[model samples]
Target chain A: MHDTTDQHLFERVLQDNDQLADENRHHFDDMGAYVVNFMSAPGAGKTTLILELAKRLKDKLSVSVIEGDMVGDLDAERLRTAGVSAFQISTGRSCHLDAAMIARLLHATPHPEGQMIIIENVGNLVCPAEFPLGEHLRIVLLSVTEGDDKPIKYPVIFHNCDAVVLTKTDLIDHVDFNFETVEKTVKALNPKVELFKVSTKNGDGLDEFLAWLEARHSITLTASAV
Target chain B: MHEAAVALAILKRAVAAAEASAQKEEKAYAETAENTAPIFDVVKIVVQVGEFRNIDAESLEFTFSALRKEFPRTQNTELELINIKAIALCSLQNHQFHPEPANYFSCTICGGGIQNLISGKELDIVNIEIEQCLTETAA
Candidate 1:
């Protein structure tokens, strides 16, 4: 091996990732499905919110979930129990799932026919935000337990997201979460991002969230039909 | 941190360039002894680290130093980091926004508040400077 030829190695690394990104986009388009990459910190209620959404929209919309975690198939199991088709992706030592990983996972699992696919990214407010998985929309979750300053602290995730979900809203009374402050911070990061405040246990504001999903699905269907 | 990864990438590039320059100089030195001259004294690598990228300058420097040690050709080279500030443009407010000091604003038109993060979130190697040795003129 030539010692000075190491420069080509750098180009190869970047090129490999770029190719993976392209393949992911192609798969997403070929399936004629809209993918939503769900990102948030730990205990942000991503799984619970997804289960709730699946329960509500499963009959009307074909829903599938791709659960990502360092280990354990608990999230996929939870979705299956909720009557939603699910696949688990255990990343092992990886902090964030890249497009290459997702592309391989999609190949292993059967694609949902003309359905909406949700990828629950590893519970990270940072690294996952930097890598794009060819998802149509990026949704970020912030629970009441996390504090109102989360949007300000993890601004990159908030800024890149198409929508922000305030989960575990039922605990607002128990926790010191200031809705006004959180809203102010979120709006400051993304002026046009759709905001949804939801509670899976109490069934509060869930209808609005479901309506938003249906509206987005309808738009995608219409656009694809044309 | 991701910046450490980025710095490693930069260091590899710099070392590669230095090796190439050294090779060219060696070739010239063999062909004409009179033209034997130093290719460059030092190489300056300018990188822009942005706040949005969440890269720690100190961590990047440390990582770069460690990686540079592996490249003997770039042992004497210097790594220069130039941070590029980040700015956010709020569609609601129709204004250029900055985040230093961390200020948030509310839009008057739609009553929607906006936060304009102005600094941090940049990761790039903007340019590099190389020093060339001068040749002596014969009288």
Candidate 2:
């Protein structure tokens, strides 16, 4: 006999990934670490900003980094040379770091020492936005050299992130970047998001950003304790 | 491409769904000694892809076609993807309008910012169809 049956799933494809992410959250909570997931286009100054942030946070709090890259560990190497705790995950073909990748690393190795953990996701504006890495905060960096219209052109990334950092302010004069447009557009997309303008070359605006991070870190730690 | 990964995910889920149905059919037809175990064949799969997901249909289909061969259950399956439009509700006037991909921050009707997204961030499997066949041997 020939018979057909139709089943309705109506299931979200990312549900598995999201469940894994929640498990990662439990691991982070047990370790009492505040996690941050950073995303940006390639060469958007993510490495430089992370390097500087790690250096500053190291003095008062223990900080470690998990860098995700498609190739070499150049960025992770730089962080280690500066005496920061860093581990690298090389994603051979994947453009984004899913929660499963983090689970593999966290389970295989001992917890990296730190009250704060930073995950520098593989550089891509589109795909990275789809994956969540169990971070307390999500930041998307946009360099002035990449133009101010990026917030509007890639609205989904800006909309989903917790914050947006305007990087490479030192090169703003050389490029045709508009700060007002970027701020306005990002605000329209995510009104509650924190905005920061930073220049790793000059160390400008790093203090304010760091202060905000510290405050959030303390709040996260306090919340986890109870 | 990320589409390749997505295609694999879709195929994996579809295969599992078919296997589940086949198990039930096998149990129900067990009473007939002459009836052979049921064979399950996936016929069609419907997926809804949101505009915000930024997935290219051509690339997804190409990868799915190549991967379906690897899964015996889905070798005969056909994939149908429906594009979900990007929609936003205006904060000021409560108007709902389809926003352009480049400029989704603002509502076209009221010229006000979006309050919240009403729809279009969905990457979901709507349904799947399977054909089950039973062979009766001579008593």
Candidate 3:
């Protein structure tokens, strides 16, 4: 029996301290809060959706946002104007926002009472999906302009996401985006994932989306009450 | 994309281990001239990486090369990446582990569902096979 040294090496590697982000996740859980990690490709309307969700839910629920980008605080600035507490996390040259980054952002922006924090991860489908920010929900947004085959091309992101929010439905008529194909593919990848088709411009289907969110919040509250 | 960060973490750990091993060997060599041998020779480092980990092997290789240049002792070490296939273990029913590579794995018992990241999510230094250098006196 060639005592395979590989297994010993693997165990040693696993023992390495690679979880600097786990602490932040513990803090988030302690707050009895829900964090939504929003991911998508560049210009997929993540910021716009955050703005809309903030405005609609701010009065009803305590809402804050941790906006991530390669540089600049533009998204955080925009979120601030929308009347939601916003904190910007510029990744410098990093492509994705990891749990460590979110943990730092949390220190900069303390958890607010009765509010759920939304982490708008840097717009990249691949890298963002790899790191978990201890979010209760992972929402991957796809706009009509990005095409329908996106789910197929990036199945990992779709598969890991708790829900898929299809943005820019207002331009569905302008583009040849097929809802059927997108829905079918997403379902095939993840049957239990909640799907929402929304148009921020026209406010179409937003109410239903909000209702779904309210139900989720209510469930959280009930669980916490016990 | 984020492989650089992962690579950095792995490199730091490897360096620490190498340094510790090297120091122990150096102490033993000082005690006896016959025990004097080059701590280890350059060979290969095998690492198991999970598919879901999203580690770019090429990028990691590049980063390692650059980092190794800074640490003269670790130069010329080859990084052999082994991708581990992920198996989804559903938290729903009795924490059952599923070996199937599917889009998602659900637990039938608790309904607690999570993407089973089975194998590919690894960043480890599997083994370093170093050639034991013979002392000048022995030769």
Candidate 4:
């Protein structure tokens, strides 16, 4: 053991994650599937929103979900029951689902090609933003009950997301949630991020959200056609 | 929560790179790289911690300290984290400032709307201090 003190610029920590994410992207591109990674804090109603989306787009496009949780296939089962092909990825103790996990799941479960893969990331705000699951869209759900300052408090997730969905709007009037503040904060954080407010319970604001999704899904359809 | 996995990733990546370097050395110089590689002991790891990343340095350090022993080379490695302050830049005012007490960030200077992020999301190893075995070569 020759001991010499030498400081070497060895690695940037997330480079391996980036490589795997790239591989996931290449796989999606090859399969002609547009992947969307959905993230939110626990109880922010990500699953509810997903269920609503599946209900709306069931016939418009081929859709599937990769449910990521620390444990249980409850979400996957729910999605399957809701009439969408769903795959479960139990991350065990891992907080966030990495690209390698997605790649492995894709290889293992043969979902219909050209179907959109909506990855419902583990219910955490912080870690999921750091990981890119090779998704074309990164959608972050911020429920009204979680407070409006979430965009500022949890800035990275809000800033990094391609789209922001304000879920559980049915509780807006019942709670002290200031929609104005959330909107202002979101705009302040990321001007480019598309904002959609929806109540999965009432099906309110589902049209606009579904339209946005259909537009994105159409990109895959066009690409596949080409 | 993610810190443990992150610590593990750091060790895994460092060890993998060291091994790859050793192999390349063995192949290239026939024996020089291998001879100079010593034992692939990682002495210190410097990770740039960004405020926006939401990873607590204390938590990461604790995790790294606890998990380093699991790996071959990182048993005694010191994990050094450089805290990169999260900067909030107001696009309207064309200004950037550290969001002090930084939660619920707004432009500290001007009350601008767009808080454009300049930096502080880094998740990379800035540098690594390792034990390198040096030897005299045919000059």
Cα lDDT tens digits for candidate 3, A44-131: 9999988998899977888878888999999988887767788888899999887777766566536343458888999998888777
Better of 1 and 2 by lDDT: 2
Worst 10 residues of 2 chain A by lDDT: A106-115
Is 1 or 2 the stronger prediction by TM-score? 2
Q: What's the chain B TM-score of candidate 3? A: 0.64
Q: Order of candidates by lDDT, top first?
A: 2, 4, 1, 3
Find the 10 residues in a row with the least total lDDT in model 1 chain B: B130-139
> Residues B17-53, candidate 1, lDDT per residue (tens digit)?
6656666666666567575543443356767666666
Encode model 1's per-residue lDDT on A1-226: one tens digit a residue. Answer: 1222212221321334457777887787778777888999988999999888888877777888989898999999988987888888898876677787888877774744447888999998977876778787889999999998888778778878889999998888899988888777777667778999999889998999878877887897688788
* Candidates arranged by TM-score, highest first: 2, 4, 3, 1
Candidate 4 CAPRI level: medium
Error of 2 at A148 (Å): 1.8
Candidate 2 RMSD to the real structure: 2.3
Give the per-residue lDDT of model 2 (tens digit) for B1-139: 6888788888989888888987787766777765667677788999999877768899999999999999978987899999998787876798887766355467777666656778878899999998875454423
Q: Poorest 10 consecutive residues of model 1 chain A by lDDT?
A: A1-10
Off by over 4 Å in 1: A1-19, A109-114, B1-45, B63-79, B90-93, B105-121, B128-139
Residues B21-74 of candidate 4 have per-residue lDDT tens digits of: 555555455455433333456778788887778787889989899998888777
| Candidate 4 residue runs with Cα over 4 Å from true position | A1-3, A219-226, B20-37, B99-104, B113-116, B132-139
- How accurate is chain B of model 2, given as a TM-score from 0 to 1? 0.87
True contacts kept of 2: 0.70
